[model samples]
Target chain A: MKGAEIFVQSLLREGVDTIFGHPGGAILPINDALYDSPIRHILTRHEQGAVHMAEGYARATGRPGVVLVTSGPGGTNVVTGLTNAFMDSTPIVVFTGQVPTPVIGNDAFQEADIVGITRSCTKHNYLVKDVRDLARIIKEAFYIARTGRPGPVLVDIPKDVSMSECEFVYPESVHLRGYKPTIVGHAGQIRRAAEMIAQAQRPVIYAGGGVIHAGASEELRTLAELTVIPVTCTLMGLGGFPGVHELWLGMLGMHGTVAANMAMNDADLVIAIGARFDDRVTGNLEEFCVGAKFIHIDIDPSSIGKNVRVDLPIVGDAKHCLQRLLQELRSIDKDWKAAHADWLAQIAAWQAKYPLRYHQEPEGELLPQFVCEQIYEVTQGEAIITTEVGQHQMWAAQYYHFMRPRQFITSGGLGTMGFGFPAAIGAQVAYPDALVIDIAGDGSFQMTMQELATAVQYDLPVIVAILNNHSLGMVRQWQQFFYGGRYADSSLEVSPDYVKLAEAFGAVGLRATRPEEVRPVLEKAIRLRRPTVIDFVVKTDENVFPMIPAGGSIKDMLLA
Target chain B: MPTANDEIQRHIFGLLVENKVGVLGRITGLFSARGFNIDCLSVAETEDPTVSRITLVTAGDSRILEQVQKQLNKLIDVIKVMDLSEEPHIARELVLIKVNAGAETREEVFRIASIFRGKIVDVTPKTYTLEVTGDEDKIRAVINLLKPLGIREMVRTGTIAIARGQRVL
Candidate 1:
């Protein structure tokens, strides 16, 4: 068997049904091998789009996303996607073609050291030198990408190695000597955490994307309900628990709701499950949640006490820890609802105070928040929404009350601008019947608008709600509040007619300039069931409120 | 009392990383990219064929050092990192020093080497080469003494350390 055939066979053995990629000179053999294979290949317009699509698929499905691209610029373009996956803990395996072995170090055309470039970002990367080791290396790449705090991995195959011939055998499993991630929490620590929970009068459950990755949403829901604690999710953890529950305090962070931030500040016993206390969420780290004894549970040991030291640290997967914790709480069999009525009432009262608000635009001018609400209404709160970074992402997170895990996808860590549309394409590929929407900003959507062709070619009905504010809305909002309204280089005057651009790409296009036109335009486009874009000319200076000034404490939230 | 200056002490970190290509590049690139200075670094494949051990010496204040620890822990290639600065540990560095000594001074060079427990590894008409292994202070003291004997050239394999007693990396 040839090396390329062996690679295809190994992918089949790993149950890879789909792949997102772009081709170049060095990867011709692999592309040739893919020509007759049963696997579906999504040929994205750019390498970055390919990788982000794979990320979207992985985040939405809890499966490892696969990407294949050619050498040099192909490999470098995927670096941003790799960094984003590393930060968000999405499992993606990227196979980049390298220059033939003979010229790997000679600075040959179409050649670059991708392994070196992605060394800091990837969980583990391999450069296959021997055809005999190719199958095993591929298996290892998949295994490392999907296990133990999931993340991105890369396998760089030199062109010569792919063209070389050898017998193929895919390894059943991998045993990495230096790679052991602690999965189950220590029994002693679980018991201690349970006891603390039982004693606390005021407790808050702060969850992150780790819960969704661990498939522990059910267990987390059980723990939160039984404990009668209000839950607030990080931006990455938006869909880990039901967003419409009575105890849901919305996302907690720099752009988090007034209620969530106030609740976090007032809590006495903070039960942080699967969420790292990142600086964005934990405003003024030293003063964050003062006097709270934390019960930190996470799969990664380094995240246990890396930021805020906890009273009880449980190093284990969220599902396993939550299961054991549920049992511990069951042994007591006591009612917690009666234990913290005042606390819940206090949180509810705060939730009533300025809970994610925006003013009605006079003369029917459009607002981004209103657009998100209309999307929520049209989709009946069930669309698998992916978002690019900035104000639009926050509005979608705030407006759409996600009720299940894997329903909302966004670049939380790296916060890449053009991430949404590609990710939405990936999600659409995963769930063909589900409504997948990319809530994007004009500034961000233009970054990767080339992917519209990919969507049209594949007959995907993915929707792009381009909140065309004619500028970078988030930066402009920051300038208004923080920088004395000296909006420098942030304003991007509307030049491209997005609706016309969508039509040029053989997709349906719509526009809604007035507030009343918003819902009807969304309704009409979503009904078309093909690739569609709704260019919404929104108010340029509409700010996302409940802002915690950088380096400010949670209690110091500014609500407008 | 220790001043603010002492807070920025040199910290020795023991990292167990995958024995893969470009692993060292990731470690060094991180320091250089983040504007952190690496005082010294030494790497070698450990007993396990699939893993490597790296000893990195960096100087930073506590805040900066904490940031380094957090950022390093985020990398996938870096399997484990243990800070050995606050613990009792054993550290050693090996240096090959060539001295510009003739027959008359060669005897004196060998005498000085013997006093420092250094072995004479090479001999030439113009120079006598010596091999010495010790901790940082010990290595620096030997180098200082060898300067008087007309040092020609010298190179050091940076420090490697392990925690003392039952503590393991």
Candidate 2:
């Protein structure tokens, strides 16, 4: 059998039902092999679109999404998308076709050092030179991409190797000489963490993307309730904790709420589970947790102290670690209340004081914040909301209350400008019944605005709310706030009208500039049940409130 | 003296593989299967056309090193592998650091960038993008120096290395 056939068969063993990709010359053999295979291949218009779609599929379905493209430009095109998925910890297996192995150094047509270009972005990658290793390599790639702290993995297959024939025996398990990720927790460390958690009065649980990947949300919720500790989630950790729950303090980061930050600052003990303390979360490293005892639990040992320092570190899967901690915490001290009544009241006061306010008109323009709240209300916080990175992303993260895990997907780590639209399409494909919306800024919407065709072609009903400010709002805001209002190249002065652009892509489009027009158009678009872009021309110079100025302390927030 | 659970002494590696197309894919695939993280990796071709040496610094045990050697050898185009942790190696990484600077802070950034011998890549009225290349420690030192100046954006191309020996990968 051919090497590509062996690779396909290995994917079958792993129960992968579908792959999204754009075909190319170097990967023709794999395409040929896929012809008769059980795996379904969804042809994307752009290689980057295919990758984003795969990422969306992975994020929504909790399965490793697969993509295949030709080498060179095809491979390079998927690099940014892979980097996006990598930063968000999405499990994606990307296969790129390469020039024939013998012609590798000849500088053949359409050949680029794809693997070299993508080394930093991928968790791991491989090139199957010999047919004998094809099945093993594919199996290993899927395993690495889906297990533990999941991320994108690339497999570069040479055209010659794909065509070469060899006996295929799919390995039952992978035995790599250099890699062994720890799965079990250290008993001693778990005991110490439990002891610390039991003793603390003002304990806070910091959840992250790891909680979702380990399928430990239930355990996390149980632990949080059993100990009466409040919970705060990272941007990627949005759906892990129910946003409306009394103990939930919402997503905490650069744009996190005052209550969440205050709660975090005042905590005596922080139980960090599956969450790495990104710089956005801990504004000042030294001031992050002055007197708090940190008990960090993560599967990847490297991540323990890579960012924030930990007092007692327990290395294991979040689920396993939580289970162990629960067992060790049987002797609970009921009389121990951290006596943070005053602090909790202060948090409540802060929440009420700066509750994501926007000028609302009863009969005027619908505020972007109000639109998000309406969507949240209509969808009942169940729909998945993906956003292109910018003002709209921050607004959605701030105003929208996501209640389920893997519901609010955005370009967090890489902060890619145009990730929302394609990602929403991908997410909708993964969850056909759930409502999916791409909350995008006017400038960021145009970056991948071409994907409207893909949505219309597939008949995917995705509502895209374009927060049109007629400029790169975030940069312009930065310019306004920091650069003495010197707006340089931050305006989208020249671009096709978005309503017309939507028509060009064969999708319904609506324009709502005022508050009264906002709900009517949005309600209509939602009812139309087809892909539509609601262009809402928001007020210019309307900065995202509660701004944490660059290098500005949390105390320096410009709350208006 | 190496117990099964010693603080896995991190090893920095510098690999010179064939500049051929799939060389990186093969080498990375090997390290990935063993779950070894290539913390800092940079790859560029030397004067030679038939070869491109990849500098990768990774943490692993003796078993991992052996596996890296064996699996790397299994690839057809991987010409050679050099563990820089064992030899005198020259390691470097480049970073494009953009800092939010006003009139007062701009001078501080310029001074630090000058001290580090970094070139100013892009300059706006409120921001200065500096491009600096050096070892991990140097990069960290530069970042530390600029911290007081307010780093607005930063991108590091991890670590790239070449062994200082008569032989080349």
* lDDT of every model, 2 decimals: 0.90, 0.80
lDDT for A244 (candidate 1): 91
lDDT of 1 by residue, A412-508 (tens): 9898999999999999999999999999999999999999999999999999999989999888988998889899989896468998999999998
Clashes of each: 0, 13
Residue-by-residue lDDT tens digits, candidate 2, A187-269: 99888887887777677889998998888888888887777678889888888888888778876667777777767888889
The list of candidate 1 runs beyond 4 A from truth reads B1-20, B30-37, B45-53, B58-89, B99-111, B122-128, B146-150, B162-169
Summarize candidate 2's per-residue lDDT along B57-77 as a digit string, tens digits. Answer: 677666555445544543435
lDDT of 1: 0.90
In model 2, where do residues sit more than 4 Å from their true spots? A336-343, A363-366, B1-169
